[model samples]
Target: MSTPHCLRSSWHAAPANGGRRENGRVNDFDPTAYLPDDLLERIRERAPRHDRENTFPEADLDELRDAGYLAILVPAELGGAGLGLAEASALQQRLAGAAPATALAINMHLVWTGVAKVLSDRGVDALRFVQEGAVAGDVFGFGISEAGNDLVLFGSGTDAAPQADGGYAFTGTKIFTSLAPVWTQLGLHGLDTTSPDGPKMVYAFVPRSEESAGRIVTRDDWDTLGMRGTQSRTTELHCAVAPPERVARRIDPGPNPDPLVFGIFSVFELLLASVYTGIARRALDLAVAAAAKRTSKRTGKPYSQDPDIRWRIAGMALAYDALPPQLDALARDVDGLADHGTRWFSLLSGMKHRAVTAAKTIVDDAVLVAGGSSYFASNELGRLYRDVLAGLFHPSDPESAHSTVATAWLGPLED
Candidate 1:
């Protein structure tokens, strides 16, 4: 009945999620304004409709901007709260605890924060695009995933061919461009072949409205079964990319060698686990609540009185409390990330694999406990069940993440 002590930390509330700092680092953040109870309530009110129509939660988007969550990842010195990915991951878990749609939609804003980290100072224009979204009351989501692309690799069929003025023109398709429909500003994360310097995978932060037409960036509609409210659309960015000076890293067509950036992958994995954890928690909550009232047809006993049902409930609760120490350990290690090696990648990946898998098990237990109630659309647990099922395949399939982590751990010793 009470909130978990691990999550009851002073952080994970407003502005503590990932607010940026004044100089654009975490030190510059103001966490108080961002994590009020009111914002969570606002997000919940829109979940059902957002799911039913498969539309972006525009109202909630407005609320997020007003709360300054768009810059939550920015440091306090940078005129934003400087919440790091570790904190953001926790924030996401809490948000997902309330509504998967809300958490999923907010990812776009977070990835833009990724661009901010990757770019450092070279991304002034990109940073402006993100800030402008805050000003305009919209959050930018990325269109990076393609349906056919393997989950393990950063695959892109889209290309940014050269333009005469020194900027490259991006052409080709990108899928699962989540948050594009609601984002006023957009960025297509891809490899551009036309850079004045050389080929590279750079983020092109451009506008989404008709005003940016001849300048490039187009969107195609998307409809999906789970996280339907995210509006993950297809986008065609057939426009000039940022000049070399305005861009971040040039495209690495092959695997990135640097392990520090691997932390981003860990952050993503943690965020998804957070989302799945929240969904599983809600599902279990509903199941436990429903079990109290529903009587079994066979024995005319309350569902809660059934031995099997009680066991399932206990299992789900165990999962909810199981992984915090692991996740928290990962969070603390982030402060000393500069000292991390390949071992960091292995540990983080393993943690993600474990946490997500546990969340999946909780979902299974939730469905078994709820029985028929989980099948109804009106039931939040039902929506959550679908969302949890989707998580098993999210980011990378469970098999790949496991193998990848396992190989990372053993590959060095053998070599």
Candidate 2:
């Protein structure tokens, strides 16, 4: 399939020398340049401290912002790297390998920018502010997840009261609000049941700076078993207002095929899958290192020489290898606007499911390969073991993924 005309403007592809246009200036597009080895080492060194103290990785965020990592998805004309979702996925995987919590937290911000990119490429410019905001160093928070609202994206439990000035006053609690401490703008959705066209699902962004005080509250209730650095605290909205210009979409609720809905799901799932895939890569690397270092007392040789140990590592590698290709392909599909129709949901969700489940399994085996020492709190593997579990809780979870895929394959179970 041919790529979209908008994407052909050098936003999705770079020259053979890896030169990309950033604000009309030619620059290298090397992933390592954006996230250098030294930077990743610094982030990796801080992961344990953040996890132990249950604190957010403020330094990581600062370094990432300084490196222009946050603007990777925005167009070059907007002073960003002008990369595609496929490139963004690869970068997220690399970032996650160094610090999963930081990657997960930043994922929320990227989701908004990514969705904007997706929409803009398709000629829907409603979310152009998201792209421009990202370029301007604005941090975005994902506030779509609400407590017990399983019909995500399709429905909202929060109330989006329409104001006379074409704005929305949102009132509800949003859970798992990542980047809670630093988000400058929050992209969220709520139900507007009292409008003339009642039952519209409203998508909007509320200012999170001091300018919008008292209307929004961020709860410091982020203590969790893993992914602690995400600081995904709960947020309370006391009629928080999204100004007229900030109101992005107000579509009919429940399974509608809106561009906003598709953009969010596609970007969110693909980037999410990328993070877990990175975790699996990290786990696999750790296992390989451990195997080569540990000696088998029975054979007086390194564990790497042991048949069973080698087999276990091979299994992990096999599982880890399958995900990146799928991520790259699907991400390219989204970037190129290849048609997938209704199957897009199933494919996206399935990719996320495969990534998380494989990451968990790979991490589990990694701990085993590293032996009892890995069980210690100081061991990185121990931290990873805890961090990988957070994947099960994200959207398109095991049950939901299976259900979506099953329904796509089998006609919605006679309903």
Candidate 3:
């Protein structure tokens, strides 16, 4: 297919070296430089097409992989850019501004790579293979969510039967498995009650292979209101095998405050927040542009002159301004190894919930500012409205986030 005019213009202006690192070490790499305007514009142009077709953003993924984004978090010694979480959060926000579903789907891969970086920084080298794998062209997908498992990371519905070969066979159903179409490896956890250790939660990565037929089933049912390009489908694991070397960690069930748990939560929530914050930023910018260009028939002047329009844009900005710094600070803290103890969960979850809520509100206001034009399905704002809704379904949901914050403030309810 021919490139759209909007994308063609960007393609003509793209720089020769947009996303690659000049030196071997990119410790001081700028996040804004991670994705060029041309690349982002291309991703933006493709978003609606994928949304309309209800298909995965394979093109977007290909472009991102070509840009070496999947290896952004791997250490310099491990053949990666070696950038930190703060940098990655910035890049994610930028990516989300162009294509929310693309950003979200890629966030799954980033979460695992980010977790590997977090673990390596904290002296836990178990997930170093994740970084190495990414550099080696392996894509990781998060497969942690399950049906009726409110305990989240602290609990599991999958059964992990130990094998004499030191591997474990996972049997369970994982829902909302993003990157379903192209993930090379899936990071998941299950409970092994029959083990000698007695009921340990086993975390491992299962490689995707056609040779292992009937083990991993990726359902083609991913129809949704927004972020359709994510293709996050239901996955059924019929004794899916993870070799002994792929077993990342095993911890006691029920709130066992392990580093692996902390790393996953911190990276996942912060990166998730970054994506929504980017959405909010894009919505706010669109509102500004629409207001400046649109004219009100009554006044014969641009809507930018209208007091109501001005106030609405200001309100959107007010909500949007607080998130980036908060994300940066918290991400920096994680990179710096600052210890927040139990407060970390509350902070991470609260930030994610707030970003999602704020992005939704900003998108709503943007649609209002754009008038009825944005109401049409072809409008970017309309697509953003749908894409932002998926944030509510992610972990650290509104109710759970509030409960976590409340518990942090008042302590858990008496037994």
> Tens digits of per-residue lDDT for model 2 on 73-184?
8888889888888888988999999999999999999999999987777667899898889888899999999888888887888999999999999999999999999999
Report how far residue 156 has shifted in candidate 2, in Å: 1.1
Clash tally, candidates in order: 42, 0, 0
What is the C-alpha lDDT profile of model 3 across 323-405, one tens digit per residue?
A: 99899888987786666655777888889989999999999999999999998999999999999999998888888888888
Error of 3 at 282 (Å): 0.6
lDDT of each: 0.61, 0.87, 0.86
For model 2, the stretches where C-alpha displacement exceeds 4 angstroms are 1-29
Candidates 1 and 2, the one with greater lDDT? 2
Give the poorly placed runs of model 1, Cα more than 4 Å off: 1-33, 114-138, 151-155, 164-166, 192-199, 209-211, 214-220, 243-246, 258-260, 295-302, 335-338, 412-415
What is the C-alpha lDDT profile of model 1 across 227-278, one tens digit per residue?
8877777776666354543343344654554221342465565566667666
Q: Highest lDDT, which number?
A: 2
RMSD of each: 7.5, 5.3, 9.6
Worst 10 residues of 3 by lDDT: 1-10
